[model samples]
Every structure is written in C-alpha cells, then in structure tokens.
Target: MDENYSLAVPFYDLWHEDGHVPLIRELLPPLLKGVERSVIEIGAGTGLVTRVIAQETPAEIYAVEPALGMRSVLVNRLAEDPELLRRVTVLPCGALDVEVDEPVEAIVMISVLQSFPAEQRAELWRVLARQLEPGGRLVFNWRERAVPVPGDLEVMGSYEVGRHTYEVAGQVLEVAGESVTSRFVYRIRQRGVVVSEDEAVVTNHWPAEERLVSELEAAGFSRDAAPEGMEVWRLP
Candidate 1:
C-alpha cells in the first residue's frame, strides 16, 4: 500500500464522502444480501465503507488498513458504536500480508485497486483468493480509463474547517504504460493565506477492462454483471 495516505488522511472523508462513497452505498448492498458469515474490506479507510458494510449485514468484518494515520481514524470511528467495536476488527497490515482466521464469504475493495501496480496485481489476486471461500464474491469499483495526458496543477477540492480551509490540489505528472504518476498538494489556509502545505507524489495503476478481465480470469474468477462502474467476480 502507498503510505502516501498519511498526507491525505486529514482530508480524506471530506473529499470522498461526495466522490465515490455514494456509489458504493447504492451498488454494494445487493451483493451482501446473503453474506452472513464474515467479510473482508481491503482498504477500509476511516470506517466510511466499513460502516456501510456493518449496516447491511451482521457479519464479522476484517477491515484492513496499513496507513497509521488512516487506521487511527478508523479505530476511533468504530469505537463510537459499541456494536461496531465488537463486530469489526482492524488489521494493521498491507494487502499482500493480511490474513484472516478463516475464509470469508465476501471481500470488498472500494477505490483501492489503484494502489496495486500491474506487477503486483497477480500476487494480490492470489492473496485475496486464499482468504475467500470458494464461490465467495470479490467486489470493487473499476472503470475502463483512457491513458491520461500530463496536466498542470488544479484544485480538486476545498473544504471549510472551522476558521481554516483545507484545500487538495493535484496534477498528473507523467504517464507510463498502465501507471500514472501524480502529485497531490494539501494546503491549509486561514483567511485566504496559506498556513501549512504538504505535497506527495504517488503512482496509480489503471488497467484497461480487457486487462482487468484477463488478470481476474487467470486467477480463477468469473465475472458477474454489476452496475456500470462496479465490478463483481466470484472465486471458483
């Protein structure tokens, strides 16, 4: 996992609540209807999607998050709800190293695929497959994307936090085959003056639909119909 999230943790929920969380709320519940045993959430950031999964089912949840900053918020979020505190377990480990006591019924990875590069995806699929029961579902958000063109910096989101405003800006720095290197700038302003600023250069992989299908298929997964931007596959 990219430890870069340590820089984005402060502004994550503020940005994603309106970005992709709503789509997960709409498209993921149906897939969990019969999942009553256990479920694993790969990149469970700050308990947003974890809360959604908890509400939809009574299954035991293993929320895997490796970033210390994000995991702290996630643990605190779960503490607020006594039921969630007892039902959810937070794993402080990366995807390739994470493990569960037993195979789970389903696995959810929302906006997490980009963290794995083309070279590691095969190992990722293999790791995930080992943790799931045969026929268990692997669900995540994915959409085919055209290669990006390098672009200048642009402010992606700005939020008011009490007397200060937090701003997140980004720029596409370079594009390699399936990897896109980008820079994210985080700034805090007080009355329009920049107070504190931090930047992180991260690389994300966006494989095409055909490549994704090929990889998943090679790992013994069969695709299932899902909403336009969502993907669901079953381990056979």
Candidate 2:
C-alpha cells in the first residue's frame, strides 16, 4: 500500500500550527553541519525541512516528494523565496524513483522513516545507499509506537489566517500489527458556517530499534552518534 496523505492535504500546514516552522529551522542546522557538496531530502513534505536545509547548507539540494498536493505547496514556497528557488530542485517522485547522477554528500529523511513498512525498509535503505557517496551520512528518526490508546484525542486549537478559520482535531485511529494509524480532522469556516471538512489518516511503522539498526547494517550502514529517536548512519 502507498503512503497516501491526501485527505487533509489542503490544510496540511494549518494542522501543524504548533510553532513547527521555527522549531525545524532551529533543529536542521546541526543535522546538516559539515556538508558542503550536495544533499538529497526524501518526502520533503510542504518543504519545511527542505527550506531550512537550503538556507543553512551551502550545498546543492535535491528534494524528492511523491504527494502532488504537498508538492504544490512546496512549489509555492519555493516561488516565494528566490534563494530557495535557485538552490533547490524539487523532484516529483519518491526516494526510490529519484535518479541521482552523482553520489550525494548526505541523505536526509526527517520524521519520514516510520511511513515505510518493515518489509520495504530494507529496499528503502538500499536505494538510499546507492545515492550516498563514501563517508556520506543518512539521518532520519525512528518513531516509537504510542498511539490508539483508549479514549485519547487531541484538540489542536483553531487557527485563523486572515478570513479563513481552521478548526483542527485529531485522534489515534488504531494500532494494527506493526503500524499505528492516526487520524486528523480539519474543519474550515469562512464565516462561521462550515464550508469544508477533511480527514487525513496516516499510518506509521514503529519496528523495534534493534530491528531497524539490523536492517541498516545489512544494507551496509554504520550508526553514528546521535540522540535517542535519531538514526545517523554512515556509508563506507
């Protein structure tokens, strides 16, 4: 099954009103330090991290994304900033499908690894391995499964950008097998009356850290020093 997140695609940024922009900008500089040649970012959703990487790193960046709706937003973001437009080349495809002529200095997939199933994780690593230059680093997060707990719902306070008001709510949908699914509901009100509503269901895999490290090891990667929940692997 494909990792489709098109339901709440229109308001994807709206749902993330938890001061994510500054947070990511602050966190990305350290992750991309010491890289000067080139970098590739997978699943560059809404170009948040991609934007930061472009700004912080003096390297050419290739951002691969499969979702059309998110790509639309990404393109808009690029257009708004000429510097980002000049530095980044947004590819309309997933990581596995991207074609890199030269091995990259780094591969970044932040908050995106959990979307791949365990069976597919190996292949994903293999594809990324082919794109990495010797001594290249691959950084991503390994999320732990902690959702769908009985009667748990988050009221993600409403937001108003000019005239359109967004009321967002979320809850854990289920914990099935190796994946935990979360659902987000967004209601758009132009003038109080409900104009539109959307639901986005996202499922993420949370394999044991040991299992993931083993998979990476099998794919010829060595773990680097990083905080918990972060995986920084090097290609030999």
Candidate maximizing lDDT: 1
Which residue pairs show collisions in model 2? none
Give the TM-score of each candidate. Answer: 0.97, 0.89
Distance from true position, residue 128, model 1, in Å? 0.7
Error of 1 at 169 (Å): 0.3
**Model 1 Cα lDDT, one tens digit per residue, 45-142:** 88899999999999999999988989999999998999999999999998899799999999999998999989999999999999999999999999
Candidate 2 error regions (>4 Å): 1-4, 17-21, 145-147, 150-153, 190-192
lDDT of 2: 0.80
Q: Judged by lDDT against the true structure, how good is candidate 1? A: 0.93
The numbered model that scores best in TM-score is 1
lDDT of 2 by residue, 125-184 (tens): 999999999999998866465444634667676788789888877787788777878877
lDDT of 2 at 127: 97
